[model samples]
Target: MKTAIVILNWNGQKLLEQFLPSVVNFSQNEADVYVADNASTDSSITYIKEHFPTVKIVENTINGGYAKGYNDALQSIEADIYCLLNSDVEVTKNWLQPVLYVFKNDKKTAIIQPKLLDFKDKTKFEYAGAAGGFVDLYGYPYCRGRVFNNLEIDNNQFNDISEIFWASGACLFIRSKVYHQLGGFDEDYFAHQEEIDLCWRTQNIGYKVKYIGTSTVYHVGGATLQETNPHKTYLNFRNSLLNVVKNVPTRWFLFVVFSRLILDGIAGIKFLFELRPIHTWAIIKAHFSFYKNFFKFLGKRRKLHKKQNYNLHTSIVWQYFALGRNRFEELR
Candidate 1:
């Protein structure tokens, strides 16, 4: 399979300098490497031209964030598989081999994510995507090797390849045909959780999203937008709600939406108690944005022929906080 490892960059010269080498070194033999520049104002473009002349550059006219950046850049590139790698991820040697093997063998698998470990520590799973991603009853996403703030150590327990509800945007491997067929990502979500929406739609169309733990990448999570950034908080909450509205089955839609509002309110209050009022305000803003886009997303939902069953766990919130189950293995 012709695989293109495209790293989406937005003024991340330092990240490119740090992590791009590993990607080029490890992935060049298995795939073509391209840095999809999102109209970066810094020396990112020039640096790549000078240091990594072999690496191609796709310069987008405007900074369209993650969704449209890839959509625009990939249109010019020809490849069977597109690896939408984050600029901050450091890929391991032979990482592309196992991922390529799976895509070639399993025609049903549309998207895949490699095991994401923390670049800072290297021994633990990263927050963006750990083993694989799964969503709870209310469209809350969590991973097998991560639950809320808890990240699991790399003990090889989640080494087996398995189907997942979503693949992390941090380092996603997806089929080109499937990606375009789904109309790329919902650009409405400028960033954050858009991958979950795409992966959920992939499943709805009878394709699978998998996690191949045999291949791994280390991610410097929150490089672009720190975890504490209110804007990140806003995008995550808003996009997650949009994901449910756009993809959740009609039968469970109302209940899920209502429950999420209540849960999010609780979250906001908790944030207030923790002296993180900005996050609380961000959630409030997210709810308003979600409300504003509700009808539009409902229209999107109406256009789909199928909405896959996504309530994998009953409630990750209840399991994690109330029941004191912080680990993935403890949930069941």
Candidate 2:
């Protein structure tokens, strides 16, 4: 199968400097590389042309955000499998081989994520997506190796290959057909949680999403946007709520929403008491805005369900909420 590797760049020249050579040297067989730049002001374009002439580079007129940037580039390419990789990741040798193995072995698998380690400190997992990802009952997404702002250490202890709720787009390998059918990443997501939305649709189509621990890549956690990155928080919070409305069944949606409301209220009160009123207020406004757009969100949710495989009362919803609260789940 033909594979096209896609990377979206936005003022990431330095990261490209460290990551490009590894990508050029390692992925040499049936795969092709494409870099879509989101109107980077930096020397990212000049650097790519000068150093990696063979790699395809698509330039955007303005910053269209991650999902739109990828959608633009993907429209022109045709491949059996599409690998969405982050610019800040350095892939290990033979990484694609194992991923290809999984894809070829399981015809039912739609997406696969590589085991990601921290680039600065290889001993730990990356913050964005360490292993595979899952969304809790409250629509919070957390990975096995990382939680909100908390990344776990790598003890080489995890070795199981199983199904996951979402595959990290940090370095995802997907079947091109499946990707096009699911309509790529939702542009409304803008940036964060877009992959989760895509994976939900994929699973709904009766396909399995797997996290293969054999293939590995090193990622610089939050390289493009650090912890205090307001863009990250805004998109994460907004898009996660959007996911619940789009994918969760009606009955389960109410349960998830009520549970989240209680947890968020307690947390907000604590923050307000501690003089951290800004954050507390931000949380309140975010949720309020989400509800304010309820009907519009519900319209989209109904649209998504027209093609859904299972309804709100299925095992999928049960498993997602059965676990304790995570990034997508709020634990009391």
Candidate 3:
């Protein structure tokens, strides 16, 4: 099977210099590598041209954020599988083999996430995507090795394949046919939580999302956007709500949105107490954006039947904060 590993970049020259070698060295035998440059103003494209001749470059016309950037770049590429990799991830040797094995074996699986660990610590799971991701009934996303800000120490407990609700966009493997069939990502999202929306839609149309924990990758979380960035917080909050509006079961939609509003308000207050008023304001702005885009995303619902291999009802927020259950095993 033909697999294309496409990294999305936007003025990320330093990140490419640091992490792109591991990807090319480890993955060249199994798949072709491509750096889909998002109209970078820096010398990123030049550096790639000089250092990595084998790596193909797909230059986007504009600095479209993650969603539109990949959408625009991928139209020209031909492959059976597309790995939407981030520029800041350092992939391990034999990473692509395990992922390809899963894709080849499980015909029902449409998307897969390898085990993601922290580049900074090496012992703990990364914040962006740990073992694999899932969303609560309220549309708050958590992962097997991560919940909220609490990251688990990698004890080799998650070194087994399991089904997941969503795969992280940081290093996601998806079927090319499935990706294009869904018309790619909703460009309005721009960035953040768009993967969850895609995964949700993939399941809605009858496909499983899985996590191959054996294929490990170290991620430098928040390289492009810091965790403390208010804009990041805003996209996360707004896009999460948009996911609920666009994909959740109609019977549970309004209730979840109402509950999330209350929950988000509390979160904003928590940020105030923590002296991060900017994030609180970001959340407020996110809600306003959500209100603006609510009807538009609501129109995007595919009205397809979605049956899950896992439980649909979960409240990661309550389990983490109120009950003090930070561990994935504890939640299970």
Ranking by lDDT: 1, 3, 2
TM-score of 2: 0.88
Cα deviation of 88, candidate 1, in Å: 0.5
On residues 52-145, what C-alpha lDDT tens digit does candidate 1 reach at each position? 9989999999999899999999999899999999999999988988888988899999999999999999999999999999999899999998
Residue pairs clashing in model 2 are: 140-327, 140-328, 141-328
Itemize residue pairs with steric clashes in candidate 1: none
- lDDT (0 to 1) per candidate: 0.93, 0.78, 0.91
TM-score of each: 0.99, 0.88, 0.97
RMSD of each: 0.8, 4.1, 1.4
TM-score of candidate 3 on Cα atoms, chains taken together: 0.97
lDDT, residue 200, candidate 2: 89
For residues 78-151, could you state the per-residue lDDT of candidate 2 as single tens digits?
89999999999999898898888888889999899989889999988877778888766667777777766556
Candidate 2 residue-wise lDDT at 237: 64
User: Which parts of model 1 are misplaced by more than 4 Å?
Assistant: none
Candidate number that wins on TM-score, 1 or 3? 1
lDDT of 2: 0.78
